[model samples]
Target: MAPIFSLFLVLITEFSLATAQQRNSNISLGSSLSPASSNSFWSSGSGQFAFGFYPNGDGFSIGIWYATIAPKTVIWTAKRDDPPFHRDSKLLLGNDGRLILQQGEDPEKTIAGGSQIGSSASMLDTGNFVLYNSRSEIIWQSFDAPTDTLLPGQKLRQFEEPNELFSSVSKDDHSTGKFRILMQEDGYLAQYPADSPNLVEYGYWDSGIKIAGNNVTLNLDDNGQLYLLNNSDNMKNLYDGGNVSDKLMYRMTLDADGIFKVYSYGLNRSDDDWKVEWSPNSVHKCDPKGVCGQNQYCILMNQEALDNVVWFNDPYSILSNTSRPDCEDECLKDYDCEVVLHKDDQCMKQRLPLKFGRQQNDPVITLVKVGGREFKKEKQSKVLIASVVVLIVAFTVLAISGVLIYKYRVKGYKKLLNSGNEELIEDVILRSFTYGELEQATNGFAEELGKGATGTVFKGLISNGKRVVAVKRLETVVAEGEREFRNEMKVIGRTHHKNLVKLLGYCNDRTNRLLVYEFISNGSLADVLFKSETKPRWEERVRIAVNVARGILYLHEECETQIIHRDIKPQNILLDERHCAKIADFGLSKLMNLNQTRTNTGVRGTRGYVAPEWHMNLPVTVKADVFSFGILFLEIICCRRSLDPDLAEAEVILVDWVFDCFDSHELDKLVQDEKVDKSKLERMVRLGIWCIQDDPSLRPSMKKVVLMLEGTVDIPTPPSPSSFLSSI
Candidate 1:
């Protein structure tokens, strides 16, 4: 009798505790949670949804997820790209009505409701985590700031600041992925690659509805019906799962593979039971614009010809061929050929990085050149046999010639020891060329390449016309030119990087000061980015930007003595034959000792690309170079000059215009017709804004800049850059 009484009391207490938690679903102010704590999340009244820390990677991410599901499905994540926090991190609804994330000893970061005050928060059954005011008016909600998934009853309003949903990285990793769905202002619901431009041509899928009003919206009703609504009260149903029961759950998601899908599950069913209710018209996975990576092709599973596959029309060469097989054979023989399109006895060969590829069921026969892996294996076996035979013969010869080799090595060592220091220096380091030699190589400096503030560059040939070089001759050989000539020689001679132009030799005979560099086949970045009729591809531009950043990083941190390339504009960035960017013109570079970090210097950079500190009479550091690189980064993104007078009044200054667009959530204006990755563009834009901050301390280090550009680190929202300019 006593044991039964004790068990009854225990059951009653447990039931009471559960009832209390359900009733108090509206979390009171000052409530806090932690991943390490047993009560890590706040559950909805029905215990179906929860809001708090969830295990992600090796750490925890704050998000709202389906609590009852076996594998909890994350619907919304806070700071998706930010690194996950450790167990010590706390998510607290502060007494001051702000939701703050406290990660150990780091600065307290506000998750939401920074500006508005809240009285309480609630994890609603509808999957919304909302903050309420004193009168219980909703201040902010997770539904308003979505990440990846959309629940029933959520509305993706058109013309809103952020009417888009980025897919998760994967089912296990909830970080922002490589695809997005946008409810555009032009009354079209479109899907594009995360990094591609927001132009119509770049979109892989879109709703065919085109209306001329801003009242368009994408809605998901509680009945599992997905649709579009306009001001006329007209509804275009995308998917109708008529009258779903309350026990059923549904979600519309932009999948990681660039597919928009609708999924449904029964509350009583097993956790893994999820049925696809709707998906875009039986489209092949290869129909998307960016499904395949660069220099790769998408093939149908059945070996059937793609319905309507189209590649970028920019063919390097077009030839008349008799048959399709002949065209394929021709492309396979040509190493430069990446793709070949055969139609009506015409063979069109395209280079690598086939762009704008999609399925359209066209009549053309497309053949992609793939590597012969089996053939390589066979060739490798033959080479292995040859190498073994060569090694045996070489070993036999070496064993017989050992005495002779020893004598020759001893004689060479004696000669090296007897050589003069001057001779050794000339042999190991830079070669000192005579003025007459440089004149002969340059053909009397007749073919000029370009002219700059300090020197004129001429195309030249050395080593009997086998090696091409660019010889730069100092202009006046007076005060500035003399300083520049010596500066360039001293700075560039010691630095060696793949992205830095190589210095082969120098000539400083009397008044003739010249420096010879490896000739780059492609023109300056400025010419390719802005002056050319056809802009370089977006991927190429991104690679070029990273190349330049790495080169700058090497100069600022990796060198024996730190150097700042004061002028980091597009004009000073040269492209090699492979379109690799190389930093040129070290004339304005300033060297710093290992111990020194800052130096007082006058302004030495181009007008549009100069750092603000240069004009403030402040001592400059490596951050000055970072600032210049920032301006150059923006130019590379938009393929426009920093300062253009022939543009609109508000858009004259590139920085001012870019900040305005970013602030207004109109970054689409920057790359109007260009195809780019939207996520990368935003990341780069944020990084660029940070780099150009007025305060040097506000800018990230060159190493951090490289990481940010390469998508390794998350970029935070940058403060307005126009404040300092306005004050000025």
Candidate 2:
């Protein structure tokens, strides 16, 4: 009778949970949270805090903050450093006992997480979202990784290990800004600009320094006094807030102007406003230099005539002293640089929407740059802004994107001109060619190089007949394709990477979209790896990896605007005569500009090479490319494809299979050539694993990845490849 009653109770509990999930009104595991979902947010039982995604800048951030506040005061972001743009993002309390933030339908990026055992997560009244273990003990808490705001029970610390402890988020965009409060090596709390990974201090107080311990921890209480607990043992007064009411909530926030302050919340009544409680020393009083980025000077503001050259013109730019049109033309060429100023031959440019006011003013007259967004729109507006073009979502048996190219140039623009649009013609950097000219070069489509569903390629000779190029003729036009073409033209026109394929020029007519590229004699990496009997030497493989890493780093860090390459695989890696890697296909990163069209329609990547984040629907960052590179690295060295179902004895999955070799200490077996340097091979293996760590934070930046390959830095042993479940 007791067993029967227990079964009945279990049925009731299951039914209740099922009902709650189906209603889409509660926060729980298996619940889908989205901007479009009705149950997008989860509030604590007391209704003091909420956990969900919110609009931030041009993107969105999954965060936890005060529920009752206007404009939403965010305290913690799952990925404070990397937020997802407007797209498909999801949050999950996984059955594996972890909390995951998914971006753009990619499940691989677990942006933030806790223990992955028998743990459960919940939003508590204390404004802490936490994960609990089997015994209900808190295993991990959001209070530990505070971004800009500090609630009552949170603590900020600095470890003896060199690391950036806390950084403030931008007040406008909610992105990581310049302001930072870090625990110095001497145990003095100081503020610095978050420009680099290494700590650079702006100011520090010597009186409160505590150099005795290995680490220092600090926290704020409900009463508003900030205190330091050295070694978590000795308590010391850092800031004494006299007679603060306990009923009001006090928060310490770092403002966008690079200042730290304390604010007390309103009383029980609605009319009370927040009051300032405490602040840092005199360092934050003035507008700090270096906060306004480089290539600009800082001076005291006076009452007289002053022009902020950086603010009025642009931030980083160049110019030549020719004519007013030429000077402004230089500034207008910059994608985002808006303002232009010129005097004599010294043309100066800057970006508007300045962060700080400058005291010094230049006499140069600043004018809105020509060829600006307005000018571009006016020029493009002449061309027919066609209705949204539809594309068929279909796939064939062969490649992820079956499109390939051959060398040819078409006199395509002549055809557009012949269409009776003479006044619409304008001088552009990328030239247009006629279809007859291309047909003459390609020998009337005689040489069929490659064919895909959407495009076809042919081999062709230039009018000079000295050099050859690859000509790809796109068959259809889609909204995404239009965006991709524009992005590709804008990016490759200015970018010059030794490891990146050069875009020679392109032709744009209504139906046909053709692109010309420098032809390479050798085929893609896939063709060589799969067809050739002799494998590429180990040294060559290492060089290719480093070269590819350099190109990726340039796009992510070195470039003015960050570029995230959604697809990275061997097929897209073109090989030159020297066996060097040149990343082909602008379609890779350009597609990232558009939100995922349909979950099942678009090709995220080739099946095995796609990162887990894409599958889980998480924020796609530069790390997505790193994950693919890791797979490529292993594939190149191990002489095996990522997934080969035909293999016997169940050795198909490359990452899992290689890690199995690492566990057995048979990593040396990866190499085919005995002449390969053992130390270099070992470094490559370790670095590859490091790049593919399950957590995005665990993956090293491309800069560090290059240094490790160059033997400038030590490579630590990598954790196991993050396939949650597998068997040999």
- Whole-model lDDT per candidate: 0.74, 0.60
Give per-residue CA lDDT, model 2, range 522-583, as digits (tens): 87788767678767655566678888888888777765555666667777788876567888
Worst 10 residues of 2 by lDDT: 399-408
Over all chains combined, what TM-score does candidate 1 have?
Answer: 0.51
lDDT over C-alpha atoms for residue 465 of model 2 = 59
Cα lDDT tens digits, model 1, 1-728, are: 99999999999998997777657698888899999989899999778899999998899999998998877788899988888899999989998788988876554677877557789999998999999999999998999898888899888877563489998877878888878898865566878778664544456677765444446888887777889888888888888765545557889988776788888878666566777888889455665656554433344444333234454454668787458677777777787676666776878787645554443444565555556210100010101111111111111101110001112212322322232223223223576789999999999999999987668999999755656789999764444565566555666676777788877779888778788887988889999988898786566677899999999999988865678888899889999866799999753446676677666655677787778887778878889899889999999988899888899988888889999999898898998876555666788899989999999999999999999987789999999874454333
Off by over 4 Å in 2: 1-28, 57-59, 81-88, 102-105, 160-169, 197-208, 242-246, 268-273, 285-289, 299-728
**Clashing residue pair totals per candidate (backbone < 3 A):** 13, 38
In model 2, the Cα lDDT at residue 673 comes to 41
Q: Which candidate ranks first by lDDT, i.e. highest?
A: 1
Q: Determine which window of 10 residues in candidate 1 has minimal summed lDDT.
A: 374-383
